[model samples]
Target: MKKLDLTKQEKEIVEHALDHWQASNLLDVDKVEELKQSIEEKGFEWKTLARYAFWVALVSLIFSVLSLFADDAMVRFVEKFYETPNIVFCLFFAGVAVGFYVLGFRNKEKYPEKTFSNETLMLAGSFATAACIGFLGQVLDRTTSHYTLLFLLSIAIYAVLSVKLHSKLIWVFTLVALGIWFATETAYHSNWGFKFWGMNYPLRFTLFGILLTTFAVWGQKRIHVLQPFQSTSYVVGLLYTMIALWCLSIFGNYSSFDAWTQVRQYHILYWGILAIALSLGLALYGMRTKDNVSRDIGFVFFILNLYTRFVEYLWDNINRTIFFLLLAVSFWFVGRWAEKVWSKGQSSER
Candidate 1:
């Protein structure tokens, strides 16, 4: 029989199962060794190190690029281009972005394994496209906060490009642009007020997140074209919801910090209750649907919400040492429980 391809963790689980089988006399020692030899274990540690190194290198590259802006000659050289029409720069960058996108696409097709390199080029193209759109927006209107319209335009462009190129990276940009547009639009409508429709920004975003998550779920079921976006949309939605809940937990519906400061934490019990209820509800739904991501998100945020409440309500009243000790104990129990659950899962899989 052909051996199944497995990750390092899976290989470890299999080896443990093999040892159990061997002890039970289900397989001979030689056969166990043969099975072990058949399994290929990739160096997970090396992969992890390489991933971190790539991020560090990318950060360094960004700083290096930024450093060029610090040079007087380079700054002046860029300023000299101010005399040129913004539309000219927009058109030029738009063409360059298109060229880069084409190259990245071709590279992705030819060398699928070189994901980092292809993605780097594609990322540059995305940034260039943003610059193009930004300059175009400025050319059309040099004054006022109408840049929100340009953000909407960018979202549209990115949505189209993501579909055409089958690029999740571009889709991520689309989501980001959409978020910016929402914020800008809300700000424009609210005139930078602390409350809109009796809710603060975080509370409002919580509603937006819930709506987006609902739409994503519905779209996944009804729209074939949206299937590829399901995971990304779900993640983004959860992030928005969790972050907004966290903020709401801290600040409630107050628009200003001064108002929040005057109000006691207990006064915000309703917000906390709502947040907890929603998180737990999502977790319950995830468990029923067998959706691990949703379940994990829900559980993690549930714990976070509880911890946040503890800090808010107990930090001042509790003894410092005893409080920390209790926290330590709580985490220890959580760790033990998680280990037990993980072990059971591994055994069941075996």
Candidate 2:
């Protein structure tokens, strides 16, 4: 059996448990000795130290660039590089992205256990890809705000790479690109107006999120390659939907902030009701269905709604001490509930 490297305290707990098991006749002496030999007491966590070292290296690299400019000769050299054409930058970043992707793939094959490093490399590649796309867009045109086309290109590139590599990080970037595309497309279509089809930005994003979530739920089984990412897509979609709903509760369908402020709080009571009701409903449904993501997000939504309402209606009328006391007590209850839920989950796993 592969040995485990555990801290001194962890090793002690394991040994104690093994001893208890032997006393209870659940494990024989030989089994207890075997279990004890299967673990080593570790004094230091080198993995964590390695990660910290990499972080310091990144910071040092940034400082090195800043320090380079402090030298007169180096500043001239950097200025000459800055004057390079956009197409050259596009090609350079494209090559850098390819290098990172190649290195990431090599690490995945050679040291599959180095999951964090592999993902970091892939993330770097994704960023380089974005930079490449931006520069390519600039190379295509010097004066045009049709950057939505750039986002479209980004979405396509990231989506293709994500599918090819089965990388969730790249998939997340694809979703981000999609969101940007949606925003820019709508804004451009509306001539950068506050109201698009008489619906505000929050309302439009809410609709987009609803569509995305519906598609995720509907296509999970049909799209084999995307099956693993279904939950991610669903949760992200629901997050977008829920955040937009929260904003709708606060701002309503008003075209401008000034107009919303001019209206009474009670005028948008229905929107708040809808948000809270959906949050509570989703929370209860998730608990019944054993969907942890939905349950946690729903609870957060419910808590945020409650706190926001209290701030809006009762902040001025209630005593400061009583208000804070109520918040503390409510949070305590929530913590206890969360503890019980986690305890139950652990017990089930054991």
lDDT of all predictions, in order shown? 0.84, 0.87
Candidate number achieving the greatest lDDT relative to the actual structure: 2
Counting clashing residue pairs in each candidate, in order, gives 0, 0
Residue 123 lDDT (model 1): 74
Report the lDDT tens digits of candidate 2 across residue range 1-350.
88999988889878878987898899999989988999998979887887777667667866887899999999888898887899999999999999999898889889988877887888889989999998998898678777898899999998888888778878889888898899888888888888888989889888988888888889765889888788878988898889999999889999998999899777998888888998888898899998888888888999898788777777787999998998899889989988998899757544
Worst 10 residues of 2 by lDDT: 53-62
The positional error of residue 288 in candidate 2, measured at the CA in angstroms, is 1.1
lDDT score of model 2? 0.87
Which ten residues in a row are the worst by lDDT in model 1? 42-51
TM agreement with the true structure for every prediction: 0.85, 0.80
Off by over 4 Å in 2: 3-78, 336-350
RMSD of each: 3.5, 4.3
